[model samples]
Target: MGHRFPAIVVLGWVLAAAALSLLVTPLGTVVERSSTAFLPEDSPTLQGLRVMDTAFGSGDTQSYVFVVITDDDGLGDGERRVYADLVSTLEDEPERVSEVQDYLGQPQARRSMTSKDGQATYLVVGLRSAVGSPASDEDVKWLRSAVEDLDAPPGTEVHVTGDPAMISDLTTAVNEASLKITAVSLFLLVGILWLVYRRVTTVLVSLVTIGVALLCTRGALAWAGEQGLALSTYTDAFVVAITLGAGTDYCVFLISRFREEYGNGLEPLDAVAEAVSRGGVRCSV
Candidate 1:
């Protein structure tokens, strides 16, 4: 749309962008970073997993988290008490927890699970959800916070780490990194455009066009996701990059040509319309 159409069109776009941004958050609910089914069908990992499933139930069905309690001096009554309390709290949730293997009153388990110098002890927590699933991630996060909240005696350190913890932390890092990249990219885009065009109006117009396009695309993706469109967590980040790249290219072409047309004696609206027609045809090719 040209400056003529934009008398109302841009306002419509701005309003639509504001409204559609709300739908974008829900799209995050469908975006998943966890799923252990990423392996190739004939891979050795898959083969081992199949064997495990046959022998001792599906490894894919249960997630595990490790609670390691460490001390430089060695295990003590304080450490054992902390482990016992955590086990009791975790066992309260039957729906979320499948088993909590505390090394209490079991000589064999304690011997095998403890470090050689007796400096560290650990508990194996089995969760009902599959590995890398959302429920499993939540359970791991909850366990981590719960263990940290315990009043362990001095010199005892509790840590939660394992397959589920790794997945949860990785996904969290990806999301935070995506947001940082997007913000930095936008800020740099504005600075670079201002340096090139040297016109405030020009810079704003181009970004507004790109922003409107991005918001519209996000709204469409969210709708498609609700209709069963499968997308990765990286989809949002990819969309931002693609939209900025393509949108900025098109905007540059149109604005530069519009300035040329205006200098050649065309009216403002006529120049924009001509720029759009010319830019659209060439960009498509």
Candidate 2:
């Protein structure tokens, strides 16, 4: 096999890597952390929610991002006006906001929505989508950007916090952490392989092959997802660990054997063949 079509062998791995790279975004979409994901379809809770949804048109609880407006000497004119303007802005942009519970003007609800000192009051902004949904994530991003540049009193602060916001934040955090961990793991693998092999070709080849293998595995998993395979959010993290660890171990075994065969005065191609027949088979099994 080594004597026949070496270029095809290398090109196959390269093309696999490219295909996986293209599927990365679609793969991310398939990993859902929604409340509905964990609930069984026939469960009482799911059935109840479905019934409620049919009755009320939306069983999903309205996600409320509390916008607290405050000042040093209690709610002043500027603070009140800012709160009103915020409510007006949300109301004007019907597409972005589903509802804005203007607790700012409702004196009856002041006790429940305001701080004990009367300096702080909050507005509950209802989201258009349920938490963990794609629509909910888009709304969260829009809400964040909308409030980011709001004109308010000198000391008045704005924050968007709710289930939707939290879910979006959690997803972003997990993705970032996974990438960082994967990078560190690969870096350490390369360093260790370099020290052990004492040859650039061996280290580079092993690492590149391992990377290609990992990409191929992930791409296959992504394709499964496309075909209605439901996977947990932790799938990506686990795949990264398993593929890298197993690939490195197998590559090391094969490379060590090849080195041994070459030291015995065998040619490069012959050494590879012998290494595959010995170490590669054991690694595979």
Candidate 3:
């Protein structure tokens, strides 16, 4: 009974961790994927990118701005020809280009918002995929090349920016950071436990308990996924923190009581039994 107390506490911790993760992670994923009443929808710029993901069956999208040089005073013949040719070229690549709306020619909102001097025009281009898509890099490269090839009046510059690429980059960075933090936290925890106990065996036992709890939590996440749950990146960290803290706390209580009895000259086995009897009662309460 004494030896089993720690195991039972660890198992309970595992079960609790698994339950919490299963309940919360999927909800987080859904919130991230769709807007709720409390949270506003993605901005129009972001919506455009999402539309590309829907249209192309790819999880990528981009928003681009193409600027062209016009006469110093206003729109000129040279600028008109350059703009027309740019539109024609973009139209030729329909698959790569999802939509192109030129302020110069389209009936878009706030037409007056285009550069009043007419020296530069804005063309909003939406890509059908995000940066992670197989053809995204190629698409960006082609856009750059096309912009370079354009016979603009002069001083024209093309700029591209959007939510899909930014979000993907941010997500990757966050994942790396989370992994580093988890690794460091685990190492520090074990080191602290070993230092406090000054016994390799005790430290190992505690670590094993933690490991079991983690596995249980991860298994729950996997099961959630199988049930069509979309987990967010934070779920793993939440599970790890909860499981480790609770498992280690339970193990510490049992181990401390056992050590106290052993110090009082009781046999190792007797001390373990007493520790379990007391710890089990406390844990149940």
Candidate 4:
């Protein structure tokens, strides 16, 4: 039984890790290709613009808005110089960019640029690519840096806003948050087990068993994936929670019975065997 438990734990952990890797690899591919991760491919209103295309053709294109801040006095000589510099930069990149409308240069575009107090100027740049196109990131980075490079009038600020970049940033933040949560939960669970058992060996054994159970569960998921199952991103968390909780519960039952037998003067090995028999019967029922 002792040898069996350790072997079971090792095999389970290895299988779980393999299964998780398999499931995650395919899921990552799907997320990137299907436009379901950082940016979606299809728009409800626009017919042809996919999230994957950075260049816009016959369909509606993705837009990036640069908000330039200045004093309420409006575009003075210094402000005009800044605007000219930005315009020249945009004009030089005609191949990558379609149109650049600055409030200071294009009076018609000024309607959209004017803030409530007229302290800020907004520039709308149209890209040649569609929403999720590779060119979109480059365009956004170029525009933001260009505005920042400009010698703005005193107290001026520049900020870039758009859906594509924002969504990409959101995905990064969510992944980080999920990782932190998982790490904290694992630490807390280990601490709780240690406190409940007060024996290093007991706690370690419990963790090993639970770990094996988790591996088995993940292996099951991986097999499902191989059979063409569509797993969600949240499936990992669900499987981990169910496996760990159930496995730990089983460990506690076994350990409790073992302790009871030991108190009655049974040898350690005999107590463990008796505990396993009792725990196994109860668990199976």
Estimate candidate 4's RMSD in Å. 6.9
Compose the digit string of candidate 2's lDDT tens values, residues 195-281.
Answer: 898889888899889888887888887778767677655677778888988988889898888889999999887777778888635
Q: List candidate 1 segments past 4 Å from native.
A: 1-19, 22-25, 29-54, 57-60, 257-285
lDDT comparing candidate 2 with the true structure: 0.73
lDDT of 3 at 137: 42
The stretch of ten residues in a row with the least summed lDDT in candidate 2 is: 32-41
Report the lDDT tens digits of candidate 1 across residue range 83-121: 889889987977787767776657678888999999998
Q: Summing lDDT over every window of 10 consecutive residues in candidate 3, give the lowest-scoring window.
A: 31-40
Compared with the true structure, all predictions reach lDDT values of: 0.76, 0.73, 0.62, 0.62
For model 2, what is the error of residue 34's alpha carbon versus the real structure, in angstroms, after optimal superposition? 12
Best by lDDT: 1
Which of the two, 3 or 4, has more TM-score? Answer: 4
Deviation of model 4 at 87, angstroms = 4.2
Q: What TM-score does model 1 achieve against the real structure?
A: 0.77
The clash count for each model shown is 0, 0, 4, 12
Q: Which regions of candidate 3 are displaced past 4 Å?
A: 1-98, 104-160, 257-285
Model 3 C-alpha lDDT versus the unseen true structure: 0.62
Q: Work out the TM-score per prediction.
A: 0.77, 0.71, 0.50, 0.56
